[model samples]
Target: MWKFILRRIVVMIPQLFILSVLIFVLAKAMPGDALTGQLENNPKMDMQTLMEIKEKLGLNDPLYVQYTRWINHLLHGDLGLSYIHQQPVIDILAERIGNTVMLAVCILVLTYLIAIPLGVISGRWNHSWADKLIVGYSYTSFATPLFIFAVMMLFLFGFTLGWFPTGGSVDIQLEQGTAAYYINKMHHLILPSLSGALIGTVGLIQYLRSEIIETKMKDFVKTARAKGVPESRIYSRHILRSSFIPIAAFLGYEITGLIGGSIFLESIFSFPGIGQLFLQSIMQRDYSVVTVLVMISGVATLVGTLLSDIILSIVDPRIRIE
Candidate 1:
């Protein structure tokens, strides 16, 4: 396991380097940079002032030189400065990464809670009403756009009935620095979390259900049943463990997808997370922030893939790493 992990870490270095190059190139190819947007916003600023700012920010350098400088700074633990905020990009990302992680955790928990049981039940009673219901849920949730779902939720809870605040992480009234504040924050989190979770649950449950159903049809399952093993024990001990392998792999990809998808969801909920920051950076054409964010997302996805491989090895020892 240690050797496999180390090997994965080694592979990630070049993978991340390639990702950095891709992100940098894409950012450059975009119609505007931070400077372009800045000049547009502050039309009063003359070309000479803009030229000075560009020089200071190394935007005046050749693209390759600038990329090399950025890579060098990354190796030295600097994420560069945000052109818009005038703060270290790492610091800005650090502030919001936690919130995004929390949201991810919430969505994951809710997805698993809803998906696992539905999947198991669907598998257990293959052609029954429960299976149909679960299938319906999976299709509907998976097919719906997250932004549209968020909008519908906001309309139902916020605008039409006024049951919940329209947007934002929390109400300012609960800023008394007490448990009440935290509780209110959690309350406000419910809608956004639910939106993300519902999106995830549909896919997860369907995948798990398919895996479970396939496992149930296998020789081992038939033999176990023939040998008079209790159905519950067979399911709990054998089927669940066997079916989880595929589910685990799917979950890894889901982690990466969730972060990527959160951009729209966070904006809809007005949640102050890394996704929202990413969107803001894009709007402002903050190349530094954009590159850093792209790198972060890339790293996360690579890590998820590595984790899935590691877990696969652990679950089935036949997958020994070379």
Candidate 2:
């Protein structure tokens, strides 16, 4: 396992290099950069001033040179300055990432807690009323667009019912570190978290249900039943374990979603997280922030993939990492 992990980490070096290049090229390919957007409306900004600004930003440099400088700074732990925010990219990300991580963690926990058991029960009871009900629910949840769901939730829970705060991480006026402050924070979190979790849960329930049902039909499960094993034990000991492998893989991709997938949801909820930051950065053509965000997301994806491999190996002895 250690060797496999090390090998994967080693492999990721080149992958990340390629990924960084792609991110840089893509950011550069965008029609304009931060300076252009910032100065676009200012008719008083002359060509010479724009040229000087480009030089200051190294935008006048060849693409290769710019990429080299960017990557060099990146390697030295300097994520560069955010053109829009006038702050270090790292500092901006640090402020926002915590909120996103909190949101992601909540969504993940809620998804697995609700999806897994429900999937198992639905599979076990296949075609019964319980299964039918769950199937209907899954389809309904799956078919609902996240933005629409978020809007509906905000209206019902936040606007009309007045059960939860509609937006923001916390009430701006609330004193930090107090119990009421934390309570308000959690209250604000509920709708967005539920929005993310409900979307994720639908897919998880469908996948796990299929896996469990298939695993139940496998020869080993048949043998266990033929050997007079109790139904509960067969399910708990054999079926679930066998069926969980695919779910583990799905979890890896979901890990990336924790950060990346929250963009639309966050925008809808007015959540102060990296997703919102990402959206703003794109609109402003903030290359530094955008590139750093892409790198962070790429790293997260690689880590998640590695974690999934380790988890799969642990759960299924048959899945030995080479």
Candidate 3:
């Protein structure tokens, strides 16, 4: 098991290396550097001053030189400075990443809770009304863009019925550190979380549904049914357990999708998370922040993938034994 884990960890190294290189290269390929429009609209600044600032920031340097410096700083645990925020990229994100993670976690839990049961029931009773209804809902979710859903949810929940707050991670009007405050925070999460969960549920539901259908046809399940095992037991103990392999394998990808999708929802809801920061950074041409943010997301994906592998291995002893 240790050896398997070690091998997986080693594999991540090259993957991250390639991702970092690609992220840096693509970031540099953007239309202009952070200093492009710095003086264009500023009447007080002159061309020479702008040029000097560019020199200081190594904007005038060759691509190889800039990449070397950036990669070195990255290796040394420095994520570089954000031109827009006027702070270290890490520092700016430190204040905001937690909100994004919290939101992601909420959506993830909700997605699984709702998706798994629906998938199981639909797959268990293939061609039934419940299955058709779930399939239709899944198709609709796939068809609708996340941002549009977020806007609709915001308008309905935040305005029409006035059920939930539309924006912000928490309500400042409430006393901090109190039960009401935390509860209010969760309340603020409901609209966005629900929208994200609905969209995120599609893939999991389809995947698990297929797995369940396939598991039902397996020899063990056939034997269980042949012996007149209890229906609930055969469904849960036999079918569900066998179907978990696919769902378990999907864990890492599920999270990566959530964080990536958060960018759209965060903007629509005006949530102060990394997704919002990432958009702002790109508009401002703050490639430093963009590069770092992409790398962070890449890291999350790589680590999550590793976790999923470890989980599957632990759960199915055959993987470790092999």
Candidate 4:
């Protein structure tokens, strides 16, 4: 297992390099620079001063040289300086990535908790009233746009009943680490986290339900039933245990989506996270910030896929990687 994981980690380097190149190229292709909008707003600025500013930001460098310099900085743990924010790209990412990680963890936990049991039950009674209810709920969540649901929830819960805070991750006055701080923070997170979890749960439930139903009908399941094991034991211990093979695999694939999908959900709630940071960088055309964040996401995807493969090998010993 260690060898397999080590090999996978080694392979991620090239993937990250490609991801960085793509992010750089895409950012350059965008319509404006960090100073474009600023210059537009300041028509009084002289052309020479504008050119100097561009030179200061290294916009005067050849694209290849700029890219090479950026890559070198990335290796040296300098994610390049943000042109708009005038801060290190790492600093900008550091400020926001934690919030995104927190939200992602919450969504993952909520998804597994809600999806597994609901899916198992739905699969157990595939044609029953419970199944119909689960199906309907999952479909509804799957079909709804996350932002729209967030707005509706905000209006109903925050505006109409006034039960929850509408936007932002905290009261803005809290010092950001105390218990009181977390309480206020979590209260604000509920809506955005719920929005993300709801969408994830819907997809997980459907996938798990299908996998479980299929697994439960296997020959081993029939043998377990024939041996007169208690129905609950046969279903839970046998059926679901086997079903988890697929569940783990699904989780590995969905890990990327769990993080990437937060862009819209976080934006709606005004949550400070990687997604929000990515959006801000895009608007400002901060290529350094965009590069680091995309690299992060790319590395995450590679890790997730490799982890899934490793988990599958462990769960099913018949599978081997050499």
Candidate 5:
């Protein structure tokens, strides 16, 4: 397992390099840049001043030179400056990433807690009313768009009922570190977290239910039943255990989504997370911030995939990493 993890880490180096190149090229190729947007809005800005600003930003440099400089700084833990915010890219990300991580963790926990057992039960009781109800819920949840769900939730819970704040990570008026502040923070988290979790839960439930049903048909399960193993033990030790392999494998992708946060949901909820930050950076053409965020996401996805593979290997002795 350790060797496999090391190999995966080594493999990520080249993938990260390629990802950086693609992100940098695409960002540069975009029609408008931060400077161009600034110049457009400030048409009276003198050419001399514009040239100086471009030089300062290394905009006049060759593409390779700029990329080289950016990579060098990145290796030294400098994420460069956000043109829009005039702050270090890392700083901006730092402020937002915690919120995104918090939101993602909440969504992940809620999704698993709600989806897994329900899926198992639905599969075990196939054709029953409970199974039918779960199936209906899964389909409905999957069919509904995330943005629409978020809006409806906000309208119902925020506007009409006023049970929670409509948006933001916390109430600005609340004193930080106080009980009111933390309570308000959790209150703000509920809608956005539920929005993401509901969307995620549908797919998980569907997958796990299918896995459980399939695993129940395996020869091992039939053998266990023939041996008169306790029904609960057979289900838990054999069926559910085997069913988890596929779910564990898929968890990698889910982890990536959770870390990145849901862009539409975050935007609708006005949550200060990496998703909203990414959107704002794109609008402002803040390539430094955009590049860092993309790189982080890509790396996170790769790591998650690796972790999933390791977990699968651990859970299923039949599977081995080369």
Candidate 6:
């Protein structure tokens, strides 16, 4: 497994290089840099001054020259400076990525915790009342827009009932590192996390339910039933395990996506997370931040694919990677 992972890592080198090139080129291609936008807003700044500013920032360099410098900095753990924030891109990311990771991880665990057993029961029951209820839940969540659901949650739970904070990740007034501070942070996260999880669980439920129902029709399940296997044992020991292969693969990709957060969801909740930061940087034309974020997302996608392979092999003994 270690050797296999190492081999996969080696394969990813070229892919990463390609991804970096695309990300950098595309970001640079976006018309107008931060300096241009800033200078335009300040009408007094003459074209010559703008040119001088661009030159100082090396924005006037050739594409190849800029890319070579950017890639070299990237290879050495330097993500460059954020044009909008006037700070290192990594520094800004360090401040925001944790919030996104924490929220995303909570959403992921909650989504699966609620989705898996509910899916199993729904599939096992097939056409029963409980199955209908779970199906209804999945459908409702599917139909509801993420932002609409997030807004409804914020209004009902946060604004109306006053059960949770309306927005933001924590109460800034509270003393950091204190027990109360942590509790308050969790409290603030509840609505957003639950909102995201509720929306996310729909696909998982559908996937698991369909897989389970399909698996039950297989000859092995019928053979077990014919051999006098207990219904519980057949479903628990045989069917449930077999049905998880696709779901595991699905979850591997799902985990990587959490790092990006939902722009609508995070924006609605005023959550200080990577998604919101990405949107802000884009509006401000922060090339460094935008490119690095895309690079990170690209890396995550590659890692997610690798994880899917590993998970598929784990869930199904027949799968092997050389």
Tens digit per residue, CA lDDT, model 2, 1-322: 8999999999999999999999999998989888887788688987789889888877889999999999999989999998788999989989888899989999999889999988988998899999999999999997888888889988998899998887899999999999999998888888899888888898889988998888899999999999999999999899987788888877788888778679987898999899999999998888889888888999999999988888888877888887
Candidate 4 residues 1-322, lDDT tens each?
7887898888887887778888888878878876776677788877788899889878889999989998888788888788778887778888887888888888888888888889988988999999999999998998898778878877888889988887777888889779999999778877777777777888778887888889888999889889988889987788887777778876677778877788887877788888988888887777668778888888788888987898888887777876
Write down the TM-score for model 4: 0.94
State candidate 3's TM-score.
Answer: 0.94
lDDT of 3 by residue, 1-322 (tens): 7887788788889998899889988987778767766776578888899899989988789988988899899899999987767899889989999889999999999999999999988899989999999999999999998888889999988999999887898977899899999998898888899999998899889988999888889998889889999989998787898788768877877788877988998898889999998888888888889888889899988888877877787766667633
**Candidate 3 local lDDT, residue 30:** 75
Candidate 6, residues 1-322, lDDT tens digits: the string is 7789999999999999999889988987899888888787888998999899889978889999999999999889999997677899888989988888889888999999999999999999999999999999999999998889999999999889999898898998999999999999999888999998999999999999999999999999999999999999999888998998899888779988676556777888999988898888899888788898888888988999999888887778888887
Each candidate's lDDT (Cα)? 0.85, 0.89, 0.87, 0.82, 0.87, 0.89
Q: Model 5 segments beyond 4 Å from truth?
A: 259-261
- Return the TM-score for each candidate structure: 0.94, 0.96, 0.94, 0.94, 0.95, 0.95
Off by over 4 Å in 6: none
Better of 1 and 5 by lDDT: 5
Off by over 4 Å in 4: none
Q: Write the per-residue lDDT of candidate 1 for residues 223-291, one digit (tens) a residue.
A: 999999999999988999888877766667778888987898889888888899999988888878988
- Candidate 1: the clashing residue pairs are none
Pick the winner on lDDT between candidates 2 and 5.
Answer: 2
Backbone collisions counted per model: 0, 0, 0, 0, 0, 0
**RMSD each, Å:** 1.8, 1.5, 1.7, 1.8, 1.5, 1.5
